[model samples]
Target chain A: MSAALAVEGLTVGYAGAPVLDGLALAVAPGEVVALLGANGAGKTTLLRALSGLTAPRAGRVLLDGADLSDLSVEDRARRGLAQVPEGRSVVTELTVDENLHLGALWCHPGRAARRVAVARTYDLFEPLARRRSSLGHQLSGGERQMLALGRALLARPRVLLLDEPSLGLAPRVVSQLMGVLRATARETGLTVLLAEQNVTSALSIADRGVVLSLGAVVVDAPAAELADDPALRHAYLGF
Target chain B: MDRLVFLLATGLARGLVVALFALSLVIVWRAARLVNFAQAAVATVAVFAAFAVTGATGSFWAGLAAALLTGAAVNAAVERGLVRRVPQGSPLPGMIVAIGLVMVLQSALGIAFGPRHRPMAAPFDERPFVVGGVPLLSPYDLFVLTVALALVGLLAWLFNGTTLGLQLRASAAAPEVSRLLGVRVPRMVTLGWALSGAVAALAALLLVPTELGLNAHSADLLFVHAFTVAVLGGLDSPTGALIGGVLVGVLVSLVTGYLGAGVAPLAVLALLTLVLLVRPAGIFAAAQVRAA
Candidate 1:
């Protein structure tokens, strides 16, 4: 089958500093792929390139089967391209309900229907549902992550691009979040391509794994196979 | 008792004017986190337009319309041309440029109109009524009060209800986020400046009849009153600005009516200093912006 999301020959930089240089990767439909790399390995940069927040120097980032190059950020969002940015990207001044409404801003067929969709996301992440009245600023680190995940899902994207979902969380919270991710992918067939630093947990939940070294993919294999390979573990996962 | 009452009554009337001026200040601040220090000068330019047009036609309505239109046009031009040039520059530079523009605007108006006092007809009648066996107030005072209240309500609704208002509020709270969300942030700022200019013009239009007269000096010190209102109300809230305006107006009127007219600015300056030292947010300021 054709790849659900693909990045080929991606080149991106900031202020003349080339962070991601001619990188390539792909994720099949309904698959969960973990992008594992060390800090400064252009992990976050690649995700940003995919989201159109960072303009690539040269590359093609495909969503489903279409090119996402010409679309504006909000336009890209309306077309079901959602990015739960590294730092929990929540609107602090807005109430949680208002933030959720913003997530469904593009789901224009019917807001009542979208509200039901948001409610499902709430059910998936019960902690976020409980704190539905709270402000984004008031949520704890773990709660913020759940809220971020919940928000991205509300956009109802074909494939969800999550950057560093496991950052600054308890071990159990990370596992719980991973479980939610795995379940969402299995049931919803929502393609997911995540860049993360939490090696063990990401590999545990993901079906496949891609390791980056100096902005180039060095290894791509089945998650279970990579976990058992000791040599690959030391280079990328520090295991 | 009579001295106290007269001072208080006079102060109260002028307080309404102060309130209108303050409301204008707050409206601009809310939309763009920058203080259009040039607003006072812009108002002067707008009032000049009002004086000439009304003075020529001897029609208060004509002058008022002319003044407001001119304010909007000037505001639009400045925002699109000058302000847009330095859209994301440091605040201090923007402020300096505003002050410089004030001098330029004043000079431009002076060159065109000359330093002259022109007669402007009052929008309302000169009849006074007896209340408490004293000349309580004239129809003119009533008219000012009505105008102030109406402008406040209209703007309040505009800011809260309209799409323009939503864009302004969203832009004010988070410019980057709004831009990322595909809002044309520059257009929002332009609209905000135009709104502030129009309101300032409205305030000036009311003032030129009696206390302000038709000179360039007309509403020159009016800005001081506006600043007091804004500071008193808490810089963030429009409602606060209105209350501040009325408070300053009444306080100034009372002081001038009883003690002396010259001490009003001093009293306002003192009050603002107190509020800053104590509350620092007006009556409603939020967490201070720091170097991030």
Candidate 2:
């Protein structure tokens, strides 16, 4: 009934030290929200909290207005919230096709519909489609990223969370893949929340951009304005 | 020629038992990514349990089922309590645990059943028949062969068809990613151990009846054979383990018949050593298994 995602006053850490303190953001259906922050900025932690991978001591994450604090990681995924987890999320031993199929494993009863979603995932990442027989260990980094994306999309999530899609990729490959992601968002009407170190590229596709310095939200504005804001860009993004 | 046929048939059946045990290793390797030095120990425990239960109840099927369940339950508890807590823990730790299990299980059996060998009930009552005057074995071979084949088929279907199976594969391949995806990595890991125990029990149930009695020495020998088969085939490839088991079984039988009876286990170990020298990754190693 409400937005696809809403995080209010989130605070999380592994030990006692807080990494993400009072962080907040929300995105409606079909919206693209870019979370831009430097290293150690708790962007990854915030994403983890939202997907129910980590328990936050404070604040709430609402997925379609449902509080996801108590849901297990699998339960959150089952509720149509999927994350393209960092650093080789694709099961390296499984073939590309198997990884894609497992993405829909989160789809419990609507599994048949999720199969259609898997087919769409293959269609979305044609390189993965071609090398369907390859395992994650056998894939190139770009192919691995595409495979990771395909795996997440199979869940048919309303909100697709990507952690640094552009990381370790060539500029051309990153731009090309980013375009595909943006197109998928427009065509599928799926809201996307991506945390990126690539400021210029993220702003190119995002409707709105949120900047974080340390753990708190420092800037939330129109993507174009944030991109052009010299003061914010120089101070936080190093762009 | 008749003598040769007799030896081959006997050896082949023996090999089938080894192959099934090797299959247990394969299941463990696929799920836990550990070679499970304790597989033989688990199998030995199950065999003893089966003998005790079958002797008391006088029903083979009931006893066998109980043994397999015990194996699963024991392995599940161990994985959840002892093994699963250590993430990406080395295979060495598992091997150590397995070695420790050998002592504990052996001591427990010794206390309960005594150090002396105990006679076990044979699953089949059929005697070997002379078919076409050539000493064809009792078709008990047929039953064992069929069960092992069915288990293989079931595993293939489970890995290929079921969602839980996919999660299991994913968890083994990438624990961190699987965690992020919301899979209880520990739960899948526990399931892996349960699988290892179940398969080990099944293998032991099929195997123990072929011999005169159940003893720790015999169980330890079975582990050596299964381990050789697992290593020879490629730790990750279940099919390879099966082939390796059969090959070792037949080879050992032939050598014992012609050369010497005492050197068969050594021969199998030599063969596995050769395999390792050639391809340390294993003949049928999966990508992740090879990478590791």
Candidate 3:
């Protein structure tokens, strides 16, 4: 079963300066939550903090009611916290299959099991299946993003964090990618926390929306309500 | 004709050793993106450890095992203790640290063992076998070739077929993304250092018996050739390292055979200069010119 993720008073920064100061948010099990904000709104920082990439200065990240504040990134990932960072980070030296293999490394760590997991991922994303032997650097931008998403799915995480998955993608490609994501969430009940700039498309698949301005949540409501509120949308999301 | 055969045989044998040393450098560079200037120094210390073990037990195998362990331990310690403290995204600081390590290790070895040559007996008889009226490869040369090939094959398999290898490669290329995928990137980097140290020890052990003897600066000459191979092959490409090692080996052997022993270093320098002028990135780098 997918698990809930709760963040309370999460503060994170670099070089003694706070990027995300005293922020709190909650994601229910099997929920599709969109994190929307302008540039430098600390969406990436919040995702990094949740995935244990950036250390939080003060707060607790409760995963299924367990404190994950002290865990390492790998340890946090082992307990079902997986993240796909911004910029379509494909390991250029590795092949598509190898990238998917890494996603299963912490959990499976065995040849037979990892192979099976990779096969399942290929079934989910057929384009990646065809290009299993292709190096990451050889992949097109859209393919790279698909490879990243497929790799994350192979981990079987309870909650997946995606940072700017739709950036630099064509409109048709973005819609197609989001369509697959929506179906994947519905079928597997996988919880997702997606940080995105494409507000319209992000809300299309999101059950709830949380808007951040200057590292603090200003609008937290149902996706439909947040989308319908013209005043709030204009002020925070820029329409 | 016999002299040609002998030079070719000896050159090929020496080339294997150079390839191993170059491969070691390539492994470390691939994993951490830092050239280890102190590699020879690290191997010299391991040789000293082997020397001590061989003196105590009179068993070359036991000494070899000890040296391998010492080499791996030293490199892992360097990575975790010293190298990790430096910030990432820049190789200058790490390079400086490695250069400093080289000086310190050489001085320490000189103090402990004195600045004199020490004989290191090969495990096998060093007599070349006669073939077609020509003395070609010695049993020791054959052993070196076999071991080098086997180690290279094992490493190739490790990097191509294993999960740890995948993580190591991925971690080296993109640490942040690898971390996101649950790869313990730091651990993998440390493991790469350990593997590199062990391989560097193997290179030193092979080359020392062929040298005048073991000394504080014995591996320095070999390190120069190996460094040339690393640069010639492009630091990032292992295949480049292998081919570069062979090219340097054969080049040195042919030059010494025809031109004279004194002119070999000049030949290496000339070749390096020519390659720099023509293909600065390397023979094996992608066609696009990489930025400095």
True lDDT of residue A20, candidate 1: 80
Runs in model 3 lying further than 4 Å from the true structure: A1-3, A14-17, B287-292
**Most accurate candidate by lDDT:** 3
Query: Judged by TM-score relative to the true structure, which candidate is superior, 1 or 3?
Result: 3
Over the stretch B15-36, how does candidate 1's per-residue lDDT look in tens digits? 7787877877777776667777
Q: Report the poorest 10 consecutive residues by lDDT, candidate 1 chain B.
A: B283-292
Ranking of all predicted structures according to TM-score, beginning with the best and ending with the worst: 3, 2, 1
Q: Please provide, for model 3 over B167-234, each residue's C-alpha lDDT reduced to its tens digit, 9 standing for 90 to 100.
A: 88888778878887777888999999999999989889888998889999988977888888888988
In terms of lDDT, the poorest run of 10 residues in model 1 chain A is A102-111
| Candidate 2 local distance difference test against the native | 0.80
Residue-wise C-alpha lDDT for candidate 3, range A1-239, written one tens digit per residue = 42499999998875366788889888988899999999999999999899888888888898998999888888888888888888857887778988889888878767898888889888877888889999888888888999988888888888999999999999988998899899989998889999999999999999999999888898899999988889988999887
- Ranked by TM-score, the better of candidates 2 and 3 is 3
Q: Per-residue lDDT for A88 in model 2?
A: 61
Model 3 Cα RMSD, 1 decimal: 2.3
Which is the better candidate, 1 or 3, if ranked by DockQ? 3
**Candidate 2 chain A — worst ten consecutive residues by lDDT sum?**
A102-111
